[model samples]
Target chain A: MAKMTLDQLRKLREEKKGDMVRREVEGKEIQIIVGMGTCGIAAGAKEAFDAIVQTVDENGIASSVVIRQTGCMGLCHVEPTVEVVMPGMPATIYGRVDAEVARQIVRRHVVEKNLVENHIYDRPAVDIVKK
Target chain B: MHFSVSDFLLDLVQNSIEAGARTVTVRVVEDRGLIEASVGDDGKGMDEAVKAKAMDPFWTDGEKHARRRVGLGIPFLVHALRQAGGDWELESAPGSGTLWRFSFPADGVDTPPLGDMAGLALSAMAFDGDYELVMERRAPARGTEWTVRRSELRDAVGELTDAGSLTLARAFLESQEEPLDGIE
Candidate 1:
């Protein structure tokens, strides 16, 4: 559905370059890691990855968040898993994440400082939701 | 194991990325109902023993957790190719680069589906490294040929590491992929 050319991409990149490339990857405030192994892709991790990318950019937190896709973490059973790590959060990992759930994570968990508790399949068992 | 053709292709390319490859080339050509593909990389090549073992399904590294990595790469690829009545070849050395070439009938009964090509291409481009990935797609029957390069993409999108840049890169890939009517 998208018809992009190098000229168009260059224009779009100019608009985005100044804001997104200001910080190094390790210097970002939040890190979003999506599982993208064969198991994960077959389960639709790419859609989730795209959703997170769009959501973070739309929320104007592109400078603060870094998104990456990693190989299988040996969690093939519950694929399409995503790991979120921020300053005060416990680096929770969510499972069965499609595009919709991915957006909720960025909007609610990353922006509003609330955890998507139900989707979190891995995290320290504690009530760490922001007050 | 039953992923789309693109996914399988991406899996093969991912091995190069994980091996710290600085440049990778992927070529796919479909003409006269035959598909020929190759992935070449300037990554750490395998030695003779390891290279031979890589293609043996029963070979093991003797590590406690070694079961996962074995037979998943070349062995499985050869198995799939055989099932489709195809063949393959791999050439590599410790210092030199690695290249794998294979072919199969496009209409083979077991030819995998070509999944979200944009997604596959994006994922291949976004690996964390100062590298370039060049993908060449050709369809002689349709008189079509196109190439996508990751370095140019990074130059255009600023960087592929973050959400903003990746979203742009993904869109660019989707645009390049004419999925509905063509083999791109």
Candidate 2:
């Protein structure tokens, strides 16, 4: 429902300056994906996609970002889901994702180079509870 | 609440986006003896094995892909169409993309009749520059052939996000159902 303007987009383009570019995969980075299933769509996947793409573009790190799409990742409960892959780092899946969380992922992990522990979906530990 | 074939088309276009397709094309044509809707996207293409299981009622592409959840769309579509006296086809080449072609009796029970088609066509085509969605309607009796593209809307809307611009976008789609130059 939020509408974006060319000037606002351009302003965002300018303010973020060099930091908001898309990651250059040429360096060292992993593939990051947002599940685009039917559930996800109803849950707001497009907004997440826009956030991710906008972050990467604004920062100008085109090479490091490999954005891709996937079918249902089986987590309808978490409707809007995101998966981040980093070399040597375990692939992290985040559920209930929105634009805010997506921005945080880019800021903490992609920029500041630290993962946001609270937002991560720790399934192994959660699986223990099912028993 | 009640969704028509146009709703289904809109839903699938959203699915195509979830599949990570940068661009999606949708076409609906009623020619010869068939009325068909074809949706194609350049997203993550599933392999034969995965593709084979994709349409199964209970088959869900699991964690190897992403979060865990139940998947039941394509199968439902297949069922809904067959009941209406038609068949559905899905084709995909890994790393290339996926194509889903659904055909049903031009006038069938399984197929929800079309509704607010012009609106659906406009909304589906109005994606954010990234995904290009096209909707073509070709019907025999009316000889109506309408094609709507996202780029056209993009050109019209420009960067105007004021209340006026949003209203205009909504109005443009609403107005598309009227008599146009070429189609129908």
Angstrom error of the Cα, residue A97, model 2: value is 19
- Over the stretch B1-184, how does candidate 1's per-residue lDDT look in tens digits? 6366676677778778776688999888888787888889998888889888877866634332334543354566777888889878888887677898988888899876546667777888876778899988876665446688998888888767677778888777767765434434
Best-fitting candidate, measured by lDDT? Answer: 1
Compute fnat per model: 0.58, 0.04
Using DockQ as the measure, the top candidate is 1
RMSD to truth, every model: 5.8, 10.1
List model 2 lDDT by residue over A1-131, tens digit each: 12333344445434433442332334776566777656665577656765776676456554466665564565666757888887666688888789988888766776666776766774532322334
Candidate 2 residue B174 Cα shift, in angstroms, is 3.8
Which has the greatest TM-score?
Answer: 1
Weakest ten-residue segment in model 1 chain B by summed lDDT: B62-71
The DockQ of each candidate is 0.35, 0.05
Recovered share of real interface contacts in candidate 1: 0.58
Q: Candidate 2 local accuracy as lDDT? A: 0.62
Q: For model 1, which pairs clash?
A: none
- Return the TM-score for each candidate structure: 0.81, 0.54
